[model samples]
Target: MTLLTYRTQARWAVAVVNSKKATAEFYDVETNKRIPRTAWTADMKAFAAEKAANVPKPPFVFRLTIIGWIVVALLAAGFGVMTYETLKPTEQSAEQVAMEQTPVVGDMYFGRFEGAAEPDSLVAISDLGFGWFKIVKVEGDTYFVAKSTDMSKQHQPKEQLESAEFEEEGTPAKIVEQTGWQLTLEAIDESVTFYVTDKK
Candidate 1:
């Protein structure tokens, strides 16, 4: 090995030799200008800082993945509810069908009579509005019934003292009186009982 020596007038001497390829090396020479020996603390600190900088922070790619899953779940839930509403059958109940099977008024057509139709026939079968040149009686008209989907917004009309008795307002249906009976326009309204007739 080649030895490079440095010396001064006070007799301090130091040798510089191969020190792992161009890395900084130190010597204890009093003169001739050589770098003093020291530990590589700065390099270690820089390495630690670089490692810390490379670490991932929160709210990273994984967070975005979680959000995507949540959105998909919400869409699936909404689709289920709307699909249920669209596909559900909207017809009369079984109990209503059973009630309609039993006759109350001797084969006479009764539109609506609340809860159940009247047990007795009020007029001759030939004088009912349902028959040709015959008029049947009705409870109330749709004009005052306040037809609506949501009930609180409007309700079916009930009682009126000054109002005229009629069925289906002003629909040009003629009322004829004959054989001690009268014929008037018969009307149907939106109700559970009314729907039962539609099915039949």
Candidate 2:
């Protein structure tokens, strides 16, 4: 037996059908009334089909509004910025490079070093206060000229030292030996950090 209910303005009409016996019964919800079992009428079946066909169908596609487009555009812009930052060359100041790493010739840097506490001493550009300096000249293992822009008080004199040597004691410092004209300082000083640049 299958029972199908159809709704009217203020009541429900339930059509209970017995398929094996080819009979059906009509029940009224508002009056609590039922008709005696009988053969399925053509009008009743047509009414049921019409009601089934009138049901609202789901939309075929989802639509996005102006705000949705704006959201999508914003997300795209954000992703582009993040990608550019990831792939873009890092910005390094002359002083910041010197503080974190070894001193590179031809390139200038600024920062403080441990051993060169005194003024007018043979101090490496890697050692000093936060400032800018350039390895203006390099002469073998003994001498080098550096121009210092003192940003701190009592700046080290910008001049050439005849006999330059690495600082002794504290952390073992790894100074990059400029074997050729191309100065590559790959020294790693975990204790002292620095930054570098191509300009003085």
Candidate 3:
């Protein structure tokens, strides 16, 4: 009798081979099943090979080099800076925003004065065009101009509209020169309403 070693299902085991039997007997170490040496035939070898081929391999691990790590860190820093800039608040104040939205004094408005009696009259605090009512002077919230005439210059013919205060919304913007006049401006939808009273 001679000792022989072979792999069973799980582990290698030693078995005694009696030269008397035509085929060799393989003794299982764990299950103690005696298998004929013919079990490891070509077909069995092929099946074992197929099982080994189908076995899952260990997952691959990627190791970053020193340069790769530096690049990744730089990219992360850039992304952080961009995010901060995108979320940063604007520098302009509420007053500034309102001021920008309001119109200037010199800007012409397509509206008539109280006594002009014409809906198509174009007027402004200062003379902007040839045919328009121009308020030559303003004191407090009062506007000094003349009555509408055939010509634009004739419109503000020594007529004065005066008021101590005027209505306003948002931040009050300087529509004209900050002369002693309290030039109040109010925005109504797509048009602006101007009110002036005799200087108090």
Query: Each candidate: what lDDT?
Result: 0.31, 0.42, 0.38
lDDT of 3 by residue, 1-200 (tens): 22133222311132222222122234567767765657576765565556545544423223455666677799999999999999998586554443344233333222233222234657534322122233444445444333223323333422342222222212222244222222333322313333322221
Off by over 4 Å in 1: 1-64, 94-105, 112-200
Top candidate by lDDT: 2
Model 1: number of backbone collisions: 5
Candidate 3 at residue 170, lDDT? 27
- For model 2, the stretches where C-alpha displacement exceeds 4 angstroms are 1-28, 31-57, 91-173, 176-200
Among all windows of ten consecutive residues in candidate 2, which has the lowest summed lDDT? 14-23
Q: Give the per-residue lDDT of model 2 (tens digit) for 149-196.
A: 334444443332212332222222344543212232322433343232
Candidate 1 lDDT by residue in tens digits, 130-150 = 111112322232212211112
Candidate 3 runs further than 4 Å off = 1-59, 93-200
Clashes of each: 5, 17, 15
Q: Compare candidates 2 and 3 on TM-score and give the better one.
A: 2
Ranking by lDDT: 2, 3, 1
RMSD of 2: 14.0
Clashes by residue pair, model 1: 129-134, 129-135, 129-136, 135-183, 145-157
